[model samples]
Target: MLLAKVIGSVVSTQKSPSLTGKKLLLIQWVNADGSLPAQDQIRTEIAVDSVGAGEGEIVLVTCGSSARRVFPEPNDAIDMAVVGIVDSVSQNLSA
Candidate 1:
């Protein structure tokens, strides 16, 4: 799992059958400092939801084989998925 922010959304009318009805969002992975890295941008995939999140929303993303579990078809080709939206974050000891 990784931390990221939903930067934008992807609109694709034509995609794999397994991807049908899934909402694709463009998420940029954020560092521990809550800022995204520019070197190699990381994007997350979000399944269909009515959460109504937008750009700058800190979210949790699960990747790898776990990503496919978000859908009914576990064998779907998915690398990432937004699982939750962060309400707050606090570090006890400053980094």
Candidate 2:
């Protein structure tokens, strides 16, 4: 899993059958400290919105085969998905 922010959305009139009703969002990777990384250092990608995450919201992203598991078809063309919306993050600075 990875932390990311929903920066924008994608709209496609012509797409795969399995993706008929799915919402695609543009996401930018977020650092562990909840800060966004430098533009050149991060890569933004489209992800299926499973949890209804909106723009500017911090979301939990699941990629690869794990993302495919979210759909019942299992073969859905989903390489990445927004699995959860992040309300808050807590980190222990002292190890």
lDDT of each: 0.70, 0.89
lDDT of 1 by residue, 11-86 (tens): 8887777777767778777886688677767544554322456777887787776777766673476767777788
Residue-level lDDT of model 2, residues 1-95, one tens digit each, is 89999999999989887788888999999997778788788989999988888999999999998998888783468889999999888888896
List residue ranges in candidate 2 displaced over 4 A. Answer: none
Clashing pairs in model 2, backbone N/Cα/C closer than 3 A: none
Candidate of highest TM-score: 2
**Candidate 1 residue spans exceeding 4 A from truth:** 38-52
Model 2: worst 10 consecutive residues (lDDT sum): 68-77
lDDT for 79 in candidate 1 is: 66
Per-residue error for 45 in candidate 2, Å, reads 0.4
In angstroms, give how far residue 16 of model 1 lies from its true place. 0.5
Each candidate's root-mean-square deviation in Å?
Answer: 3.1, 1.4
